[model samples]
Target: MAEALADKNRYAHAPRNADWTIDQDWASYTPEEHDRWNRLFARQARVLPGRACDAFLAAKQKLELSRAGIPDFAELSERLARLTGWRVVPVAGLIPDDAFFDHLANRRFPAGAFIRPERELDYLSEPDVFHDVFGHVPLLADPVYAEFLEAYGKGGQRALRRGQLHNLARLYWYTVEFGLLATPAGLRIFGAGILSSPGESVFSLEDSSPNRIAFDLERIMRTKYIISDYQQTYFVVESFEQLLAECYQDFGALYDDLRAQPDIEAHALCAGDRVLTQGDQHYFRARGMAAE
Candidate 1:
């Protein structure tokens, strides 16, 4: 039989062992672990100044993430609080949805406490400190994006009470994890998943194999996404304020409307879509992870 889910904590809860609590042994991280953080941080920083959303770059600068070693949570949180009301909380690994929601609702971002092992630089089965802190934290400094996150967390709780969390989580996945943005300069990345990964950074915009459709709030909630690999279809937002304003508008009614309608196919494009790049979907088809 499958193992039971991990225990729920003040940070998160999940029915499967996906929920994790923070128990960071700050001083115990090996030299190699700190090296990994430095390596990943430096590499991404070099690439992000131009590719990342302005808000993200700014937040990263404000937070003063270390290029020499893994950041101490206390130090990082202090910087974050001065810019936004957000604070970073350490976690052992994934947390229960409710616990995750509660943290976000309270403006506390739960970061996976552990860094990945030396061998798993390219990938890991779960989010590591790199993915959680590097991928997600910078955007938290953007006030508009920060508000959307808090709203998203509050929405998650309501969705859980309504037994519609699966659908709601999908919305978070597509927008927060794999989202893109449209700027006068062309397309750019704001999503944590794309922001952190070097391969996806190239694949998402420059590659000819993935679809880039304009952002639509309802459409995003209805669409499916690829979790374990690069996304095939990326929703594009015009601006940060647009995403927050559109998303924060009462989703209660939108949620009801979605339940009453059919879910959009994962790969299907609608007539209403504003096509930025109509990818061949070859990269995803050849390398996509099986749907979760």
Candidate 2:
């Protein structure tokens, strides 16, 4: 990580103060940054509708996102709060899990304040503003998904105290960041990380290289993940209601029980899985692990 990213000193929680105000250096967004947002936005808008879950597509439409430019946080927050009582807050990037949970518990989402440099377009190790706002924020407009995020935030704080933050984070990873869904249309992209990228949006749904299993909270928590590449397995939920209903159930016992089990393989599919696609592991196998 760069010094600018590692120095936690520059980082601050979004929804700065009780007024819920975010001071994004809107004018400071460079032409290249805006162009990146525009390019990403145009490409995704075209790819997402049919392949993305109804909630995701609906939320994206409700927000009126465009390829015109990067959105101002103020405008986005205003519109989102109206729809789901949730707001977007600007942050320096990758805060501790505690801070991340605190913001979400209060209906505030902390987005990275910076954009990726132009040279690293296809990928960047750390999240940039485009990934945070464009990738994640649109789905926050849906009431069910918004509520689920706030609940996860609250749940995270408790899990952190019990030394179960890892468990809670897996819940988030399997849902918020890299989750899948079985919609009336078929398997769809709901995870923002997949939703924002040109290549991933298509690959996650169309690729035969990754496993797509049904969402099982316990299974998700125990499942290990790959950090070096695209996911080897993606969990699919039936609906946002199914996801929220499952999470709202007390996880205390589940967490306690899971702590005793060995971590599941990243690509393993258990008997309970409502298997969507049994991936062939082509992507990861083709590229061996690389150094940071």
In Å, residue 233's CA in model 1 sits off its true spot by 0.4
Local lDDT at 162 for model 2: 94
Estimated TM-score for each candidate: 0.89, 0.90
lDDT of 2 by residue, 180-235 (tens): 88866688888978876777788888988888988888999998877656888899
RMSD (Å) per prediction: 4.5, 3.6
| lDDT by residue for model 1 (1-292), tens | 1222222111234223333445455787678778989999888888776788777887787888667788888788888888888999888677788989999999999998677766678877688788899999989988889999999899888998888787887778777888888888888888888888988888888899777889887888788776677777889989878887887765778888888878776767788998888878776566653232
Candidate 2 accuracy as TM-score: 0.90
Backbone-clash count (model 1): 12
Candidate 1 stretches with Cα past 4 Å from truth are 1-21, 287-292
lDDT leader: 2
Off by over 4 Å in 2: 1-22, 289-292
Error of 1 at 248 (Å): 1.2
